[model samples]
Target: MHPESEDDSLQRHRLHPSSLLFSFLGQAKQFFLPFLLLFFAAGDSWELWFALLIIPVLVFDTYRFLTMRYRFAPAELIVTGGVLTKNERHVPYARIQNIDLKQGPIQRLLEVAEVRIETASGAEPEAIFKVLSLSAVQRMRGRVFAERGEARPEDADEASAGRTEPAPRPELINSLGPKDLILLGLNPGRGMGVVAVLWGLAWQMGLFDGALNFESILKFFTGSEEGSVLGYSALALGFLVSLFLLSITWHFLRLFDYRLELRGDDFLSQGGLFTRHSTTIPRQRIQLISISESPLQRWMQRVSVKVETAGGTGQPAESRHWFAPLIHRHELQGILTTIDPHLQIEQASWQSLAPGYRYRMHKLSVIIALGIAAICQLIFWPWGWLSLIGLLPLFAWATQVESKYIAYARTGYGILFRNGAFWRQMSLTMNEKVQVVSQHQSPFDRGHRMASLRVDTAGAGQSGHKINVPYLPTARADELQADLVAAAGRGEFSW
Candidate 1:
């Protein structure tokens, strides 16, 4: 009921001139090509109609551009559009998960940045913003973060203001030199063999049929039959080798300009060759820390570390969104300790399930393998024995890997679930985030007081990471369930 604060008033409205121009230009660009094609293809009679159509479009765009304005209320940002229908939108700042700035080649030439704000709520324009000057963009970013009650450290502000000289940037943190890049590239996952195989399969399946231009290769490789065959084979080999090299080169390049800087309670990671990307993640948002070791990496005693965060595209393509793709495992413990000293992870104690449970799981794998083998025999009788032989090793491997990697760690704050065969995964989340916990007892498991405990968390996608503790004492599962329910009731994440 009191007067509004100055900060509140300052964020009350935003009028981005560049955004209006961007919107108009984007629409104009889209129509321009079609308009040009139509103008050339159509007769003069149709020209009048085109002109008439263009007039209204131009007028409507101009009117919309002139009227566009955004206002920020205490809880949300409001946008109203349309000279007639009057569409309105309310975007809550608290629900905003990410804010990104994009600039295409044309925008770069114009020296304007487009701001995109994405929210947790399911809404179109989950990201909505306008183009603005780089300086204005920076100011707006500061304001948005400020509204969220997260401001840069006092030292950073003072340094920026020239009240105190900025501290020298640490050479190692800011710049990953050629040697560091080489080391990173030498890591096992940098190899492109798997990618190549996938690409080859896609090609064989005719996925690239539409895009293929056979004439170009034919013109280049045409010669005597034997010579042509040799030349084509050599070319294919070279292409594959180049693809492998390119993957390594790209990995190295991504690390080349890598920079991680601390700004208050958050960390900023910035790096890219062609399209520079910068992400700021608050220390508290991290949900889990995982380390993975490939066959080659395990031999070398090296592994990749990743941190899972809340919300965003949980895809490898958007690796930076949910996880930092490549960090040495040895350094993982140190990083987690630095982020949250309270996090504790001990080696999981092996709790063997009932003998019947293991036997059933093993039988299930054998059954699947046998089914696949029978199908292959019907269709490929000549290669049936080989197919069955190949599947035998796979089934054996699956059983062994599952048995070896199956483990769970109980920490003060959360439970750690670890599992995998070819690729290992570990997840940790606080008790309060747990939405549901259930114990499943198969007929076999019921016979020996053994059951799988599945814990589910919120904000995770449809298939959230569910932990299955193969076998736990019923009392332990009940105790954990009670603790989780209490934490949820208190609306807190407790250790």
Candidate 2:
């Protein structure tokens, strides 16, 4: 009668029938571009070969669908399958980190979703269910969380029985409509990436085979001896405008109808235009939160917020959670409160970098600018010396403005850091979540009696932001490091 006893006695269940279709489609996507290339470039003679390739893929998918079997157990999920080797995996509920769900347009139409089971072990999901009935996924989710003590027994019972019970009312934290998405798209990032992708795609399609010419491009920029600089300037401006528009469209489409909600101890987000994604993160799993603003966003008085959680290191940038893609500056505090009460950065007593940091920043910028100017002079002699006219002032403003904003602080619940001038970012890592605290000193730092402090938490990718506070007085850095190490020792890391 109990859900536990029922699960313990249950037999292994096969994947939903639609899984065969979904698996076949997944394989088809991988070959679609190749098939197109064969048809367009290699001609109809290769059609038979392409069909032959599909035959093996179809057979593989069919065999996998038929062989795969999964079932719920008292304390773990057991998955078994394989052709000859006959592999089996038992994943304990306590070790499960994330249970993510995805549904494409077709899957949504068929009332099925793809499920990814993640753990703290690696970047890839521990297990993936290609296509499962929505009801089955709900049941699995409830069971998993229930075993972890995060869900009620009655909820698990209801889910296991496949009842159409009313869903819980989750409080809406933020919702991004078309206007908000447009605002997010207007942010000054992702343009170069979009341009690069489009250029690559065009190259693959051979759109530039005969139309592009390096010499012609040089001539266009150089123009006649009395070249039309105005004409080339307009052309460059048009290209940049096109790139910006493309970036906007990419962001808009990728995050269409985005919504964030709070359901008890979990933060849930669902978005995407073509393929909807639903991510559930337990509040305790969150490691760090970052709020960032670019020059354009600063002018608009807006900011973007994101969260880093434990596990899944090396995942793509899009896989990271966006707490608020774009929100007004005034709304940040309220959102932070909903995320956690201890993230009150505005109220924290912020500490400025070492007194010599400004001098250090200026010295570094001067060295870089002088190096650039020297290289320019080597190439353009007379005109290159004139580079200091532009470089000096630009570097001066950058160093001075950046030194003014770079700071670190200790919050009631975490350590907070603020850095950058052009693309400013503020990061907060909770004291309890801190895993490692380190201090480093270089020859340059020693010359100025300065050092850098770094705090590492779980799931922090090398490419992503973490709590690294540079340009601190050696004594100050030592003091902060000691405090953080003690705090980390006082609390236990859940993951």
Candidate 3:
């Protein structure tokens, strides 16, 4: 490799020309909305001064784009931007999590991607350079990650001597079948969307709503009042058919060609149809891994996976999960084994929550029910009673079932916490990533001789970013807290 090229790798860099479009795109809402208002307000006057207002934004974008600069220094990456005020941010290699790139259709056309730098900080992304060439992003990623291909020849022999067979290029961890993708798309954004739609239809059909005179509609469909039975049956059949078709269509669009693979030491997910997305997640940087499933998925024996890295709580939907897009419950363990072999993900084997745990959840559920019912009562008396009476049993039942599965487990490197009933969420957090472990005991918990442990990590939510294992035997909770604190201390502190 040429010395000049190696030096150029660390040299100051500028974003691609398309960055101007990116600035406009980022502030498009601000610019276009005002422009739209002007157009609506000043109809004819808009044409006269359209360029006057628009040209300034374009000129500012160009100016800011030209001034923006980034450089990879020996110890850190520095990004400088802004027009009037010079904004500078220095991110050290140790603090950096993943240097990611995202591409849309326009970005793909220009062969450029939005480069985002996520560090240990779980707030805003440290730096983002819009519309940089994919090659440049990869180069920056490589440099930040391992300083790949930039080592001196004197060190090359030393590094090469220890390495073997190029470490076998990353292979597919799991591949989605036709049925898998279909079932995945079935859940789409909401697991019960189709059911809700069908329920709405049934309500409109006078099955739930008495206002809709189905008998009249039956007379129109058939001939006499006797045809009401046939009409209801036919309508029910039509609803089922419509539900089936809608589920298939929704599933098709969301999870087409979904595949999760392990590339080198990174997790790569490639999926989507209209708007394609390929996300690369660094294995070591992952702070939390969650496996979730709905009632439909459970019946189909499938589960979805989500991995949260050190930084950026608000990630795009497509880039959410590492595996959970329609993986079978049986196959989930095996797929996860590739990433964490020592960790046990078996649902049946997890340590169940304390037996008295349900009562606490039940109490909480009742309070919530009362709160809702009271609010509804203010609107209408009958509706309030209906809300209370209707939801009380349902909430109690949900709490009962959810409390049954509330469990926690531990491995040498990681800790697991499971909760929820219909929408089960199982979180696996690395010991190293645990920032703090807090134990809380309410007056209720004290009476029951139980305590709750809340484990905090960087990738978890800012406020509620805690894995709460409630209703633990006080003695057991104390023992567990010691173990957790020791485990966290033993590992190198990672965010």
The candidate that wins on TM-score is 2
* TM-score-better candidate, 2 vs 3: 2
| Cα lDDT tens digits for candidate 1, 400-451 | 8876776776665666777766556666666555667777777856666767
> Candidate 3 lDDT (Cα, whole model)?
0.70
lDDT of 2 by residue, 74-128 (tens): 6788888877678799988878877888999999999999999888886688888
Can you tell me which runs of candidate 2 are displaced by over 4 Å?
Answer: 1-11, 32-53, 164-167, 190-227, 314-319, 374-382
Steric overlap count per candidate: 0, 0, 3
- List model 3 lDDT by residue over 171-280, tens digit each: 88776677776676555444456666567647644585566665676677777767666787877677666766677766655556767767666676766555455666
User: How good is model 2 by TM-score?
Assistant: 0.88
Q: Model 3: how large is the Cα RMSD against the reference?
A: 5.9
TM-score of each: 0.71, 0.88, 0.77
Once superposed on the true structure, which residue ranges of model 1 sit more than 4 Å away at CA?
Answer: 1-16, 28-63, 71-82, 85-93, 105-111, 123-127, 149-258, 288-291, 296-322, 346-361, 371-381, 440-450, 462-480, 490-495
What ranking emerges by TM-score with the best candidate at the front?
A: 2, 3, 1
For all candidates in order, the CA lDDT equals: 0.58, 0.80, 0.70
